[model samples]
Target: MAAKKKVAVAGLASVLLVAMVVAVAVTVTKKNGGADSGAAPVSTASKAVQAICSPTDYKATCEQSLSKANTTDPKELIEVAFNATIDSIVEGIKNSTLLKQAAADDSTKQALAICEEVLGTAVDDLKRSGGKLSEIDVSKVDGYVEDLRTWLSAVITYQETCIDAFENTTGDTGEKMKKLLKNARELSSNGLAMVTDITSIISSLPMGNVGSSRKLLAEDEGRILYHKDPSEYESGTEPKFLGKVSRQLLAHVKPNAVVAQDGSGHFKTINAAIATVPKKNNVPFLIYVKAGLYKEHVEIPKGANKIVLFGDGPFKTRITGNKNFAGGVKTFQSATVAVNADDFFARDIAIENTAGPEGHQAVALRVSGDRAVFFNVNIDGFQDTLYTHTYRQFYRDCTISGTIDFIFGDALSIFQNCRFVVRKPMEHQACMLTAQGRVDPRSTGAIIIQNGDISAEPAFLAARPPIDAYLGRPWKELSRTIIMQSNIGGFINPAGWSPWMGNFALDTLYYGEYQNRGPGSNLAHRVHWKGIRQITPQIAASWAPGRAFAGDYWIRATGIPYVA
Candidate 1:
């Protein structure tokens, strides 16, 4: 069965590549004029632009963005596209600033503020995409292309996030913001389309497997689950995957600063300790947060890279707040602990948004940094608990508890040997483990839960309310998530998944499950949506920490052991 599915997918890939190649050829010929035609030959630069942009979704935007590039190189053209996307985002920021200043109501003002912040993020991602494009190694073009697509897809997610923040705002601000960002979003999509084309052609060829060689389209097999006592999993010791280096770093390394609330450390607050760190730090700025209940909000701003934050334990040392949509704080700005820089490492810590279910869209831990790692931590909230905002992240042996859409974001992340706790919610409030927002099909943004545990809290189980809970719903058009080798409790709805809107993204989103255990893992009554399926072991492996995002590129440095 797997072989047949592989053959079908390969055939489809071949047809797609042939179509795209034909399109490029026809476009180049048309632009160069036929051999018999008496037209002047076009410049090599013009031909390059035409060929590269021909198969893109937004050809006009692609050509216009690359029109100024005089080089006859495809890579140069892509770089120009990235630059154009950056320019468009910059312009959008300007417009958002003007709108914010002119906003009358507080809601409009706050939403516009979010737009400004996310637009800056979009610019940063575009710059990173451009840098990656410049550093591509032709011999390993597959990896480079995958990286480019991931970043570009993130660029699109950032723009859409900006626009989505304007929902329910007064006036035509949302519409205006959407219009302003149309070009930027289109350019980003075009860039992703081009990058995907590279891998698509490679996969269609006979060349050895390069970057996700298989495009599995097999149906999921039904499985019977033997019910287990939830108490066993809850009481079991959490599996530790921290390597020797990580253990040493967390246990023996002296912190650069200490944050204590009892006036015993260098600083009394996390933010104060963060202020002492050098800007654009290239080396690790370690901070040991002493055992105390920190009630203040914390933010690790951009440029403060390689910050190592650890604490006594999840219950001993805690950082928490109550910012939420109900309190007029924009969801993007409501995180209790927001990590916005790269190479962020946190261990034995707990972050939470104390906002109850009534306080909707309250984010507990929001991470936007690339290559961020969280181990032995707890992210607790009611509505939106852990927000994997953007970039690449990994969480191990951590407990993330929430009510609705608890684990949500648009990042490429993996949860290995972690515990997903579903807490009791307001009446009739369904529990959603994740709401991944991968809008771009080419984007590598996904949530992969490997060897994890998903169960309800004791209070939730005691209530025994008919509160339906599912694995996830389509948060965006191309939302992608996979649960592999995990234990799902019976509290989860029999369907296994839910829908965001009335069949809005049911056909486009990608949800896969493989080799899962527990009663909830049964596939007999799972949603039969077009995008949901049971994937083969080979397909599941592609989403592993090693294969998904450049093998051990960032994970090894973080000292986190992974299933390679």
Candidate 2:
């Protein structure tokens, strides 16, 4: 079965090479005012003639044209040079015996298919290459040009060898062709591997450093100073002009009530307040935190279910910490806010980890709750900022910011009408919105961004990378994420999804996009992944907050009453 598939693939590749060759011939001849005679017949002499007129023979001419054209528009010249090289190789392959053998070999169809697939990918790489080159520093352009030239030369040689092997059909010739096919496959794999490596290296190069002024407010400076204290914080026992309130106001509040830095004068640090409540008790605990800066790390253990944390205001209440994975911490252990408890609710507060660009996977908020909710909140960080670690979670009217893999986790979560601000990375600009790690195929975990605006801090960084950045990447095998009815900004990469770590993950991950608008929502250049889905409005609607995947059980846990 495998052999047959290979043969079919080979046949398809042969046809594509033939078509490309014919197209280039017609285009060149027509441009030169020559008679548009149909493709020349395939023969030994024809193959010999083509080999003699290899791309090498015209290398000088091609280079001269490219140089001249590049002076006017380097991008156009590079594209022309690239296409011409491909054209030369395709033309050479069309009349070769390899094309005939590929068409005849049923066992080698899958191998041929692999060739075609690689070719298609190469074409895309070429297109993306132009923009990629532009992003490189001027000093590195020459190096890139030289490398591309060398790669192209090797590619042309490979094509020629494949052609020559195809032409020979005798016992020895057939064996030779099979060997050539194997070599061709290896070359394709190597080429792709090189491209992936080079692209990653280039993408990670620091483009520019993020300005220090753009950093989030420090824990000490983020204290809430409201003009008038709300009645909710005032208790009968406390009565002074701008006086502290009693804990009585928290009586009606649930036992696991969560108090932020902006709450009544009760607790100092936010973590201290979170620690005051028992993890397993059903009895409600009132955690009233005074309005002040609380620079502390907080984690609610697994048994600590049904906890609530209230704050004075979303912007005023601040919980900040910073830890990064590169500092020898596992990605899971680098979170500032790690909530393992189920039925957790937080409102009117901001949770942030200030680990800068140097920190790789420092998490600001890690929620693994079965049913967790965040309302009128803000989560800030760079890479791996907000970790919806596991289970179903919901966020309503919140703000989130990050750089690479900012919003990542292995959970089914929904962000409704939230603001996503992408902070540009200083080095090679690769900012991703979300990285969902849903390893289980049966576990339908996802990150759904519904009705949001993708904004950026720096005005220049607002224009997302052409191909370097992505809306998201699948951190797990069956990972799924969707952006629906959102105002996507220009900062989004044209290829909406990026490889998680390498191409291997691309095969197993499920990434999708639906009903997104604005400059960043262009689907023309999206990655052609088999698992990437194009969802319909109905399908997207089904994933809505009150719908199947995110339903009443999840919504009610958020403490916000939902009709559905």
- Per TM-score, the best of the predicted structures is 1
Lowest summed lDDT over 10 consecutive residues: which window, candidate 1?
A: 217-226
Per residue, candidate 1 scores C-alpha lDDT tens digits across 306-348 of 8888788898999989999889888888999998888888988
Against the unseen true structure, what C-alpha lDDT does each candidate score?
Answer: 0.80, 0.56
| Residue ranges of candidate 1 with Cα displaced over 4 Å | 1-34, 37-42, 138-146, 198-245, 248-252
lDDT of 2 by residue, 155-206 (tens): 4223322333223233344354444444333333333333333333333444
How well does candidate 2 match the true structure, expressed as C-alpha RMSD? Answer: 24.3
Which prediction has the highest lDDT against the true structure?
1
For candidate 2, the lDDT comes to 0.56
lDDT of 1 at 335: 93
